[model samples]
Target: MKRIVITGTSRGIGFEMVQLFAQQDCEILALSRNPKPVQELNLSNVTALPFDLASTKDLENVESFLKENWSSVDILINNAGKLVNKPFTEITAEELFSVYQTNAVGTFQLTQKVVPMMKSDGHVVSISTMGGVQGSLKFPGLSAYSSSKAAIITLTELLAEEYKESGPSFNVLALGAVKTEMLAEAFPGYEPPTTAREMASYIANFAQTGAQFYNGKLLQVSNSTP
Candidate 1:
């Protein structure tokens, strides 16, 4: 059975991902600051933990769990994100730092912990936003969120080059408007064509086999226009 680790599991896409992965014959670690929702699911193959991507202690706990439970991880899905939908001028320095801390720095740090436990066949998938893509139609109040997410795009490419010889391919997905909590936060009352579960389902499938055919690439998973 494949062993996987997924972050931001309290709700939306991450929550759906945990459920879908649970249906498969694999071991999963589902993490979020509020782990109660996933814990309530009581899936036998899933383990829920209270995790804060910005917290060093929490990051270490994730590493500890992997070390104690599995020899190696097959997939690491960096799905946790933070949104700061405010005018660039109104976004305080601390607010910008927090956004980056959760979306960018945390992802980079977490990968440092998981990559060591992965083989060449392993896959590391990170979720980004179309807003993070340069020239993808910018929004009014997503400066912090989008820019921080953009960092992952470059990081993925650099990692793929660094580890190309050792294995464990790295790729990122730049998603468009999906009916997710984050999307609602960014564009309130706006409806999206895709649902959270639909995106999560696609991500799950990609995490399993995309590495075989791709590395250091960003796939734009959006059917809707900005």
Candidate 2:
């Protein structure tokens, strides 16, 4: 069975992705701040680990946890993230740091820890935002969140190249607005965005194939009918 590690499994896209992978019979190391209450999803192959990514100490714990449990992981999905809606001028230093700490620093630190445990030919999928791309939109009061996502895009590209010859791989999924907590915070009263299941399915497909073409690439997902 393919072993996979996914962050942020408590809710949103991360939860959906964990469910999808579990359905596919993958060995899952699911990370969340809180334990899920779904008895149906409770399975032998699934192991849920709880840790607040915001804590620097937690990063060290993550490294130790993986080493102690699974000797290797087949895929590492950086799905856990934070979002804050504050105007650029109104954003405080603490708020900005909090966002970056969770969305970028925390994600990178986890990746660094798990990368070594990834099996040969494994893949790393980093969940990013379309807002990271230039011209995506400078949504008012979302400067901090948007800029942090942009940094994730850069991190993905650089890591992909750095580990180009390594067995494990890397890619960034620059997802559009999804009906996630992050989106709700940014666009209150807006209609529901794309469902987590849809995004999860697309990510699952990418993970199964090990498609190197997407390596180091920023993939965008939209709800526009083709």
Candidate 3:
């Protein structure tokens, strides 16, 4: 069975991913700020871990858990993210830092810790936003969120090159607006064309197979034009 590690498994796309991967018979290491949602799923193959990606203590907990339970990971999904929707003029440094802490720094630190435990041919997939793409349609009030996701995109590319000969592959999935709590908060009442479950299905399949054929690419997953 494949050993998969995923962050932000508390709700939204992360929660849906847990459901999809569980059905596929993969052993799941699910991390989230609150473990309740993942635990409630009650899949025997799933291990629910509570860790706030922005907190160093929590990140350390994740590292310790991996050390105790698993020797290597086949797939690592960095899906935890924070979105701060504020006008660029009013955005505070703290707000931008918070988003970066979860979306970029946390991912970098966790990936570094997990790489040593990744099997040869292991895959690292990070969920980025279409807003992060340089030429994609830009939206107001997402300055901090988009920039942080952009950092993940760049980081993934650099890591892919750094690890090219080591066997593990790194890729970014630049997702379009998906109907989730985060989107609702970012753009209230606006319905997105894609749903969390749909994105989860696509991401789960890619996590399992895409690395074999693609690396260091920011593949966009969306049906809507933008």
Clash count (model 3, backbone only):
0
lDDT of each: 0.94, 0.79, 0.91
> What is the overall TM-score of model 1 with all chains considered together?
0.99
Best by lDDT: 1
Q: Specify the poorest-scoring 10-residue window by lDDT in model 2.
A: 33-42
> What is the Å distance of residue 75 in model 3 from its true position?
0.5
lDDT of 2 by residue, 1-226 (tens): 8888888888888788877888888888788777563224777878887767787777787788778877788888888887888778899999999889878988888888889887658899888877777777557787888788889889988988888886577888878767777788888877665787888888888877744556887887766311
Better of 1 and 2 by TM-score: 1
Task: Tell me the tens digit of each residue's lDDT in model 3 across 16-131.
Answer: 99999999899999998899999987899999988887778877887898899987899999999999988899989899889999999989998988899997699999999989
Q: What is the C-alpha RMSD of each candidate to the true structure, in Å?
A: 0.7, 2.2, 1.1
Decoy 2 TM-score against native: 0.92
What's the lDDT for residue 53 in model 2?
76
Off by over 4 Å in 2: 37-40, 224-226
Q: Candidate 1 or 3, higher TM-score?
A: 1
Q: What pairs collide in candidate 3? A: none
Looking at model 3, report the run of 10 residues with the lowest lDDT sum: 217-226
Q: Which sequence of candidate numbers ranks them by lDDT, best first?
A: 1, 3, 2
